[model samples]
Target: MKEDAFCEEGDIVLADASEDVDDIGKAIEIVDIGGQRLVSGLHTILASRIDHRIVVGFGAYLYASSGVRKQIQQRAQGAKVLGISKTQLAEVELAYPTEAREQQKIAHCLSSLDEVIGLESHKLDALKNLKKGLMQQLFPQDVA
Candidate 1:
């Protein structure tokens, strides 16, 4: 298949056909799937937003924003594997700034914050590793 047919990075994928709907609606922006063709699991969905910023923001907001989750929950249904039809997804109201530039700005700010959070997490992990190493060196035997 053509590379263009593959799911693009930052594309939001919803696991609509999963055992638990709680785990659905995932935002896929990782590098591993870059330019990779997606088979789209049974009930998995791939949506291409008419506006990049709106979808990106909406995707990011899906998990954290109770309001958005409530909207999705309203439309979601299925006994074994909860799923929301495309029509139901469309029925969910989207609240984005009227101007595209505003949407872009908001996305930019949120992305920047996310990067900082990632960096901080890495630093904390590194510090923890260093402390562990020092402890091991100072005490050859277990300190129980």
Candidate 2:
């Protein structure tokens, strides 16, 4: 189904079709949507206006899924390298919590983990910079 849908902020976008299939299908982008950022030149599928009762936190689910990714790769190999159609993308299954409360809990947990990872990553970068500086101090300036 060709989506006549306009992407709004907070919608989950998946590059349903891409020339390079391996790295393309795994990440789900959350549109900070209502921006001047016009996403063109690439085809994507968005899961918008989701029913909280039936599905919750699809963005996180898509991020974690492997089976759907395999299916997308298989589909992409035969289709135009440019991308897959919205209808084909729609057929991809997502596993998400059916209940709203469970979905919130899962989303919270993932958010916390992401925050910790970001902090640790910043620390690692600082340590690397310190090591580089120490190494430079120990060595004389390079002669031509």
Candidate 3:
């Protein structure tokens, strides 16, 4: 792959193809590449922050937001596999805060919320497992 193909920190990569229309334009922010040459796959659209209009960690949430997703879904066209071209993606309009500090705050808050959700999900799973164990103990299966 060419040097230009390698992605850098804070770059956003979006899925261009998916069987589910709602997932066609899902975006992921690359926070780290582990010091390796990382490139987006053929099925993804790499978007770099060249103009610095949107701050880091914000594009992922921006693209995932309902407003931007609706535009992307409307632009997507396909029967079996939904797809969004670079042109169509470019046509999708998005709004963001002008102040860099505001963008940072939004990203931080969202990211912190995500962390909390993940922790809660883990606790729920553990409780479910404990319940299953208690149920097994309460009603043991008969052995032939």
- Give the poorly placed runs of model 3, Cα more than 4 Å off: none
**Residue 61 shift from truth in candidate 2, angstroms:** 3.7
Superior candidate under lDDT, 1 versus 3? 3
Question: Is candidate 2 or 3 superior in TM-score?
Answer: 3
**Which parts of model 2 have CA positions greater than 4 angstroms off?**
1-4, 26-41, 52-58, 78-82
TM-score of every candidate:
0.68, 0.73, 0.94
Worst 10 residues of 3 by lDDT: 1-10
Q: C-alpha displacement of 45 in model 3, angstroms?
A: 0.8
Candidate 2 residues 26-126, lDDT tens each? Answer: 55545454465534225566656454343344464555568777776666644446466666667777666666777668777877888999999999999
Highest lDDT against the true fold, candidate = 3
- lDDT, candidate 3, 64-104, per-residue tens: 89999999999999999999999998998888898889999
- Return the clash pairs for model 1, or none: none
Q: Which stretches of candidate 1 lie over 4 Å from their true place?
A: 1-11, 29-42, 51-64, 142-144
Ranking by TM-score: 3, 2, 1
lDDT (Cα atoms) of all candidates against the true structure: 0.64, 0.62, 0.90
Better by lDDT, candidate 3 or 2: 3
